[model samples]
Target: MDAYYNCLGCMNRQVRVLTMDGQQHEGTIVKVDRNNVYLKKESNGRVQTSAFYPGYGYGNQILTLSLFTLLAIALI
Candidate 1:
C-alpha cells in the first residue's frame, strides 16, 4: 500500500503523459494492480478511467508498489 502512494502518476504529474506515439495526456491514477494501472483523466468536462499495462516479460515489469504509493513516487 505504501508503494501506491508514490507512483509515476502521482509524481511528475504536472507534466502531461507522453505516450509512446508522442501523444500527451493528463490524468491521475485511481487504482493499480500487478497486471495494470487504472487512471482517471479529464475529458470534455468529464472524468474517464483508463487502464495501462507495462508490458509483461519486458524489463523489470513487476514493481513492488501499491496504487497510491506509486502515485507518491511519481510526485517526488
Candidate 2:
C-alpha cells in the first residue's frame, strides 16, 4: 500500500526502473494498479534501428512489472 502511494506521488512521468535482475527500463507510466505498474517503454532506442519496427520487443509493448521485482525507481 505504501508503494502504491509512493507511486501515486509521481504519476504520468518518465521513470527509470531498476529491477532485481539488474535490468533497467525507462518508460512513461500509463497505469498503476494494486499489484503492477504498466508502462509504455520508450521507443528512442529502437527508432534508430528500424523505423518500421522500432520497438525492441513487440508492437507498442507495455510493461507489467510486479512491485516485488523492482529494486528502485527514479524519475528520468
Candidate 3:
C-alpha cells in the first residue's frame, strides 16, 4: 500500500487505473489519501445539450477506490 502513496504526485493528471477485480477506471486524479484514490471519472457517452442550458454538459462523477485494491495505474 505504501507504493500507492506515490500517487500523490499524480494529482490532477489523467490516468487509467486497473483494480484487482478487473475493473478499469479512466479519469483525472482528483485526490489521493492514505486509504483511497479519488478520480473524476470520464464519461464515454456522447455529449448532449441540456434542455435548459444549451451549452452546458453534465459533469463527470467522482469515484472513490481503495488504494489496496489497485493492480495497476497508468498515465493516459
TM-score to native of every candidate shown: 0.39, 0.71, 0.73
What ranking emerges by TM-score with the best candidate at the front? 3, 2, 1
Which tens-of-lDDT digit does each residue in 1-76 have in candidate 3? Answer: 6536657867899988888999888877777778888777656763221122222234544677889998888888
The CA lDDT at 52 in model 2 is 25
Which candidate, 2 or 3, would have the higher lDDT against the true structure?
3
Q: Model 1: residues >4 Å from true position, as ranges?
A: 1-15, 49-76
The Cα error of candidate 2 at residue 60, in Å, is 4.5
Q: Write the per-residue lDDT of candidate 1 for residues 1-76, one digit (tens) a residue.
A: 4443334335424323444444445655544555444444666976443333354333312222233222322221
Could you give me the TM-score of model 2 versus the true structure?
Answer: 0.71
Question: Candidate 3: lDDT over CA atoms?
Answer: 0.71
Off by over 4 Å in 3: 45-60
**lDDT of each candidate versus the true structure:** 0.41, 0.69, 0.71
TM-score, cand. 1 vs. native: 0.39
Q: Which ten residues in a row are the worst by lDDT in model 1?
A: 60-69
> Model 3 clash tally?
0
RMSD of 2: 6.0
